[model samples]
Target chain A: MTEIKTETDPSGLVYVIGTEEEGMSWIGKESTPVEEPYAIEIRLIEHFAEGIEDPNPLYWSDEYAQQTRWASRIAPWGVIVLCKEHKVWRPEWMEDSGGQDTFFCSTPLPGNKLLATDYEVECYVPLKPGDNVFINEKIIDIKPKTFSLGEGHHITVENYFRNQNGDLCIKDSRTVFRYR
Target chain B: MQLPEIKDTYYEDVEVGDEIPEISIGPLSHTQFLFIASSHHDWYPGHHDVEYAREQGLPDIFMNATWQHALFQRVLCAWAGPNAIPRRIKYRMGKPIVRFDIVKARGVVTGKRIEKDECLVDLDIWLDKQDVDKVTKGSATVVLPSKG
Candidate 1:
């Protein structure tokens, strides 16, 4: 397997995955685990519920959640990804790099434009308030495909979320169509 | 905000071809989009900047992936009941859900089975824009409590 290298030029950041053979090398290469900046909190959970206008008692009301199996307020299943999103605020010295740089985004391909075409998520445990989360991301697969938009590759990336105790909480995967 | 009554759904009570009550949310406005974007902490330009989206060949700003997933969660869990556990959710994105598009999330029971002493239900789920075009479509697997 070829080791793809990342390079930066005056034009900006450039990641070279090389040929298809080189791109294949990225499969199974996992990134170091990164802990979420903040622990899960009821306020944050309710804020997300409000954003989506979801009135599910499980996400907000402590009394209603207490009656459920969890016996405590829990974050919505969909909010699992949001909990691991890149921190919005960064140090002033840090450059605004658009968003968190992941192997999937930096991997060089024929197409520069990207679109998320598919997603899959499996919840192992309910994300409860006060649980600290850590995430490990890896490239699962890369395949050549032609779409109506243009020719590109279908990249599948999987994200594994775990609690501070190392118990897996959610396994999420997304397939993006990168086309010219 | 008032909490809508969500009936508890049991595995024994569900049957193949039963439709989950659809949830409609849309004619989405800029404020709503910003709220979601901010909450998710997604600073992706295509999700918030109209000019950036146009530069990327999109007509206007659109919902992010996380927001799309949340739409399905809202509908499925509400119908499955509070005790139900969402084991898996998968969907394919079709047309871009841009601003002002009225999107509706829906699901139907496709099958059911018992695994590891847990009752699991399979559902085909989708999101439609204006009750016409499907902007997102896929399937989900959930664990529901049994009456027994």
Candidate 2:
């Protein structure tokens, strides 16, 4: 087994550097389920809606939402992506350590720069407040190619977000270009 | 903020070539970018720090993929009304949207079908910057209620 090398940037984002062979080896690998630190809240949903200037009453007024098929103030479908927990405050134990490890950032790929090129999402059900959300991600594809930025690979990761009852809420696939 | 009175778009009322009402987002400034970044919990420096973005070869701090996705949803839902449900969305980023770039979301109905007793409409959607550059392009599937 080759030793895996990693680098952390000033923002605490981790990058993996390895040979093409090592990169190919990452396909089909799945990350453990990561649950959001807290249950979905109405305030968080409103905050996201406000940021986008979306005034859909379904995402705002509980009274209005109660009259709809959803029966409650449900979040916008796009909020599924925001439900993932990214550590902003370092934990006491890791106060001096780099950022928390995420599957995409820790993939064994040779890249100093990363850009999201494509995004696809399918929603099965609406996420509501008090629902506990969790995600499980898998590396589905890796294609090495030369691009305008430089020589690199396009890695596609598929993420599954489910609610507390294990009902899948969203299936998202993101393609990111990792270049030099 | 006052919510707009929107008319719901029923599947029976849509035609194959009907265009959704276009909505413009910005000439985005740092304030908007910061709000979006913090709301999404994406603390990527390239999205907020101009110096870091320039160092990383970006023209300037720009909007992230998730923000663009939300913009698409906002346009779709705004046109289709609260009853419509977004089934799927697939988009590809074309150009980086930096500060002072106004993005407009537009869509045209391409097809419609009934699957599992649900009325589904397919549309081609995109985000254009400054009415010239197509900053992002994609397709989406939405479920709209039937007048029947």
Candidate 3:
């Protein structure tokens, strides 16, 4: 396979084009919402803690989690964001208008907290090692907005997390961008 | 808890195509979710709201792509250990990850080279089910401990 190089910014920042925004515009414009599901494993928890500079005992301490309300080691929100395999290809129907340099540009400028950049998490039950879970995702809504950088758009993608037993865990809304 | 102990090694010690140790994670509960949620302070009931998710045309609430991407990087974190600082990591959101999902994340040393003090290790990271191909795969560059 050919190596795809990341783009570099003038300020020496690098952009990893993990998610090729191909058919995203279609989902943003003409397509109906889409959904997908995945299985989770113990490794995910370890990754979660590594992301946010947190290595607290509770995360790995089974006894600690059992004693606490959490009842088990949980992952960090940053880990969730980072866990996504960004290089996954966009749907065949989706076309790429362009891409973003995530390193230098914070496309969704950190404001409005949840509203500006929507986030959601649900704990159906505490997860422990040796158990399997599932994740279901949907491209629910898309909205276009024009900012100082000309015409741009935002995507409202939703996700549902559950265990093999079919219990609900979490639902999330992610915003993707297309800016000039 | 402390990160798993990994021995230090130069890039020369790492051979291409070597499989880094796989890591296990999760089985989170409400309080665990709250701890993560409280830090970022970014939560939408739709993520946790079953009724809302169904209303929005989803089966149930799932994890965010960003979080999943971060979780996947732990494979690299374990391999690179303390000497390595993650320079780049990227993954795409294919499916939603519900609570209790057993996420199997791993890494392979795809490329390695030395640059003065920084011994670079290029790895291909993956997150998958116990018996599946791969859900997410991406490349990562880590600055490993130097031989010098």
For TM-score, the strongest prediction is 2
Candidate 2: TM-score?
A: 0.93
| Candidate 3 CAPRI grade | incorrect
Docking class for candidate 2: medium
- Positional deviation of A169 in candidate 1, in angstroms? 1.1
Clashing residue pairs found in predicted model 1: none
TM-score of model number 1: 0.89
In order, what DockQ does each candidate have? 0.60, 0.65, 0.03
Q: How much is B28 displaced in model 3, in angstroms?
A: 4.3
Could you give candidate 3's per-residue lDDT for residues A37-144 as a string of tens digits? 223344656555643333544455566555543455654334333333332347878774332222112223221112123333333344445434455455555456
Q: Each candidate's fnat, in order?
A: 0.71, 0.68, 0.04
* Candidate with best lDDT: 2
Q: After superposition, how far is residue A55 of candidate 2 from its true place, in Å?
A: 1.5
Q: Which ten residues in a row have the lowest lDDT in candidate 3 chain B?
A: B33-42
lDDT tens digits by residue: candidate 2, A8-64: 766667788877788889899998777866678898888888877887888888777
Point out the higher-scoring one by lDDT: 1 or 3: 1
Residue-level lDDT of model 1, residues B1-148, one tens digit each, is 5655546899999999999999988789999878876778766677888887887778899998788888888898889888888899999988889999988899999999998998999999999998466778999998998989
- List model 1 lDDT by residue over A1-180, tens digit each: 966665542213344535667677778888888887678888888888887788788887887887888899888765655555465457999876443566666776655556788999999898899998888889989999887667888999998889999999999998987666
DockQ of 2: 0.65
